[model samples]
Target: MKTLKCPLCGNELTSIFRMTKTGSLKNKYGCLICGWETFELRKNENLAWKDAKEFISKFPPIMRSHQGDNLKLDFEDDVLTLIGKDTSRGKLYLQNCDGDVEIATPEDVEQWPWELEQKGGSNDI
Candidate 1:
């Protein structure tokens, strides 16, 4: 295992268990040094071009077709945030997950811009 700095005390982090809708999830070494625990999902490592294109049409030309393995995404800005380490069992996702905040559905999240995938609306840039 790798050692990580604690966001609380700036000391080494430790292993800990956290309860979630999908039972238990792994963390980037819980913080026992200062008791400041983080329950955020890391960026998506890979996302297929098709999946991205399905969401946004302004994707790169090479992305016109499904390429790559997966797309690393911002959980906070995810249209659906599934919280699970594996594909088996169940998949928990957040509809409108935002930076450090989110909800189970898009309607539940009260934020602007909805997401990057959506454009041409009154909230457009």
Candidate 2:
């Protein structure tokens, strides 16, 4: 994978597939530190992206992992917000998920974005 550095803050950039209001998925590159991002609009051909609020509601409001960790799910500005029950764990912001955010889908939800996973994690949720 290629490394993406933020030109403004020298921080690593994160890439995610964001659903546009026009019903398209765009590959977005953004910096958690400086809030710098690139506006990239692309056409989604295969996956039928759903609304953030609607998709999140499919799962239970609270989810528990096999390791006994718990997270509360919420939606904001088309992003999936995962708030850890433990205060020290920090929040995880997700742009996409597999199926529903439930116990059965723990494996998929654990697979966070590559860049964020590398640098510990981001609390910019």
Candidate 3:
């Protein structure tokens, strides 16, 4: 059998299989270096290879963080922002005067509880 190589990083690819809750088998192809993944249910090796090849050709490569990487945080006044790595999205946190906290997105910040906003706390970090 020919070894599969990751399209984005040229690293050797690995195959993983799992049993679904419905008792069906699921097959996945993954790259440890680039964190690329594709799923298919073909039982035949040839079909699985075809699906993997198609997915690799069509899927975009995404940056991934290595193990043990630390994420940076930004604080502005009363708001805090968490910087995400790889394909993760950043998150914003809002804190109130009574020490209560709530998570919100940038677009939803304005719609957050008026009292929280009045506390002069905003996080775009």
TM-score for each candidate, following the candidate numbering = 0.25, 0.31, 0.38
> lDDT ranking from best to worst?
3, 2, 1
Clashes of each: 12, 0, 2
Tens-place lDDT per residue, model 1, 54-125, is 333353211221211111234343343333221232222332334342223323333322233333333221
Ranking by TM-score: 3, 2, 1
Model 2 ranges with Cα > 4 A deviation: 43-125
TM-score of candidate 3 against the unseen true structure:
0.38
Greater TM-score among 2 and 3 belongs to 3
Candidate that would win on TM-score: 3
Q: What is the lDDT of candidate 3?
A: 0.47
User: For residue 86, what is the lDDT in candidate 2?
Assistant: 26
Clashing pairs in 3: 79-122, 81-125
Q: Which 10 consecutive positions of candidate 3 have the poorest summed lDDT?
A: 61-70
- The digit string of per-residue lDDT tens for model 3 on 15-82 reads 76768888887677778888876666665556666676666545332222112212222333343322
